[model samples]
Target chain A: GAGVSQSPRYKVAKRGQDVALRCDPISGHVSLFWYQQALGQGPEFLTYFQNEAQLDKSGLPSDRFFAERPEGSVSTLKIQRTQQEDSAVYLCASSLSFTGGPLEQYFGPGTRLTVT
Target chain B: QQPVQSPQAVILREGEDAVINCSSSKALYSVHWYRQKHGEAPVFLMILLKGGEQKGHDKISASFNEKKQQSSLYLTASQLSCSGTYFCGTEMDSSYKLIFGSGTRLLVRP
Candidate 1:
């Protein structure tokens, strides 16, 4: 089976631009997650989805960041009016279960977004 | 809150051993360990549940202490392939979200 995958492996956007990153999770995965990793730092949680419902999104830095997973399979993270501080590697992960217990998550290669 | 990892970085020689620790301020339900090489996605290493079970494979192992809200990752007989940034993700009780540590950079030389 294929692991989690993200599109637009690299993107360069000018300040104030809007960019959408796509994530294709593993087949039959019930949980999807988005994270942001700054240079030399660990990944920080951004949002999580269970099926088609967004279960948690408190980690989003601001209103400019939005995410959706309408069909419970593929998900998208949109950043409106990108700022220089938004430049980072965006990672997507998926898990087979949503039991609120400890489950292994497989990660994607990530999308490196540079807001210049 | 995000967990704090000790010894921001460590250098090791092949066949040596090293330990990385993560401490969280909040009550934790589980802890996860991962290693990420440059220009690559993070690879999962191990997960330690609240019961204080120690899990491992190969030369890597981890221990979780529920009472202290802390976890430790042990890498024994290190190899050059173990060089990478190690991160510990802590999950609070019923939160289902993982808050990661700053990371511990490990360098192994032959």
Candidate 2:
């Protein structure tokens, strides 16, 4: 009955370091999403997963961003060789339906990644 | 493309009403609204579908004008609890992914 959960609530990484963020969606949730929130701005979509297969990833900023949902429940978003611009809050969300009116998402507290 | 939200920020007193608007250049299939307080997760507020179906609590309702590619979230008799940054996520296609707007910051004081 827990909502979406992300590990490493806070992270400090040096520029050019690689960081991996984890997300555990609600039990049996079919849809999962990743977003990046910069200071004073809204969240920007990074990627989406339906079960273990990632259907859309066009929102990923660059090649440094990679995500996988191997088991269809737990997902990991890896940022390779991070940059100072990568400093932001990474939020994970889950929803019940894939499309239409009930597309409400349940979000986690988010992992704040500070790149120095 | 990302949607656009108006009134970058607003300050209101308790019991007042506020409206947040989201407009998109592309034809939208649905619009979703959410609220996020400082240092907190974004909570779902409501969803407006293409064909006139709307979902939300009575106090917080949203309307979608399909023809104009716009949606408005109306918060009547606002409460301090309503103080937060409001975001509108737009779905242009059948995919579940949402392209979120820049967001509208709303502050309510007692």
Candidate 3:
């Protein structure tokens, strides 16, 4: 794809169920980020990855949330034992800068996760 | 900490102007601006890295004040296409992750 792409644009999961969202960043991009956005709010950072290294996960709300980029191109966000509060749009963004410097990020369509 | 944005919502007519502000409590390394419409992902508008630097494309522009840890987005001669939710993402000097503001909703009526 010419830009960032996410799979399963919409996912509905029952409480206590688990879900995984995938993100495929633009080719050759080195930095990927995951964010959660609630209704009428801005995106909150969840995690950050530089290439294949998971450098920062401080924004993750709890231990149940996990993310990985095994190949440095594609990334996945997994939430275990989902709760109602987990319902939100999960956004994926990628930047070409590898130094963790300032750069414009390209965002995906985002996967809307609905937990009931 | 999350940045704070003013004017939760605004309505503007064609050719009008609007300004959205984002303020943070901590020192920042950079500030980024993005716009997201209903059911769509955020589109990057511009990024300000240095203090007192102003940049713009077309009728939209932005300014960053590193000392006060604030940034403002300017929309001049607004068009219907400019109607959307605007967000400011802030990055601290010690981290690479972006902490975004609550957002400013702008409506442009023609």
Q: Please give each candidate's TM-score.
A: 0.97, 0.96, 0.97
Candidate 2 lDDT tens digits, B6-110: 988999999999989999999998898999999999998877888765556868988898888999999999999889999999988778778899899999999
Q: Model 2, B28: alpha-carbon shift in Å? A: 0.5
Which window of ten consecutive residues has the lowest lDDT sum in model 2 chain A?
A95-104
Candidate 2, A14-81: lDDT as tens digits: 99999999999999888999999998888899999988989889889999999999999999999999
Give me the runs in candidate 3 sitting further than 4 Å from their true place.
Answer: none
Q: After superposition, how far is residue B65 of candidate 1 from its true place, in Å?
A: 1.7
Per-model DockQ against the true two-chain complex: 0.78, 0.75, 0.81
- Distance from true position, residue A31, model 1, in Å? 0.3
- Best prediction by DockQ: 3
Candidate 3 C-alpha lDDT tens digits along A58-107: 88999999999998889999999999999999999999886746888999
Instruction: Kindly list the interface RMSD, in angstroms, of each predicted candidate in the order they appear.
Output: 0.9, 1.3, 1.2
Q: How would the docking of model 3 be graded?
A: high
Candidate 1 C-alpha lDDT tens digits along B47-103: 898988999899999999888889999999999999999999998875668888999
**How high is the lDDT of residue B70 in model 1?**
90
Considering TM-score, which of the candidate structures 1 and 2 is the better prediction for this target?
1
- Write one digit per residue (lDDT tens) for candidate 3, span B32-107: 9999999999999998985679999999999999888899999999999999999999988735688999999999
Cα-based lDDT at residue B94, candidate 1: 53
**In candidate 1, which residue ranges exceed 4 Å CA deviation?**
none
